[model samples]
Target: MEESNFTEKDISTVETSILSSVEASTVIIISVTWFDTRLQSIQWFGEMIMLIFITGLSIGENKVADKGKC
Candidate 1:
């Protein structure tokens, strides 16, 4: 049998990919909900907007940190 050890680089790559996937998923969910009649309320709309805004800022912060590390 063979065993493998994950390096720091591999971990970083996985984290970045996971973060990106989450962001994309959030966008899709928000879009679908936006068009769904069940979510037709100003309060629900605002919450979605806030969630997206926060996610955007978090992604932006990661990018900045990556730049600083380079």
Candidate 2:
């Protein structure tokens, strides 16, 4: 098996991708909440935001692992 090596630039790219995904998710969540009347938008937004944060943290941890820093 061939092992691929990633440079610092690769790690930065991953971080940027994760952040962009989070931003996209936020926009989707907002649009959904705005379109729903019965649903509690605040609660949904908060939960989704928390999920996004957790996902970002996990991605960051993975990046650290890839860098052999943890």
Off by over 4 Å in 2: 1-39
- lDDT per residue, candidate 1, 20-63, as tens digits? 66676576677777865344587566757766765676687788
Worst 10 residues of 2 by lDDT: 6-15
Q: What C-alpha lDDT does candidate 2 achieve relative to the native structure?
A: 0.70
Residue 47 of model 2: what lDDT? 61
Candidate 2 C-alpha lDDT tens digits along 18-58: 67767866776677688653547786687678677768777
Summed backbone clashes in each candidate are 0, 0
Score every model by TM-score: 0.44, 0.42
lDDT of model 2 at position 10: 44
Cα shift from native, residue 42, model 1 (Å): 0.2
Best by TM-score: 1
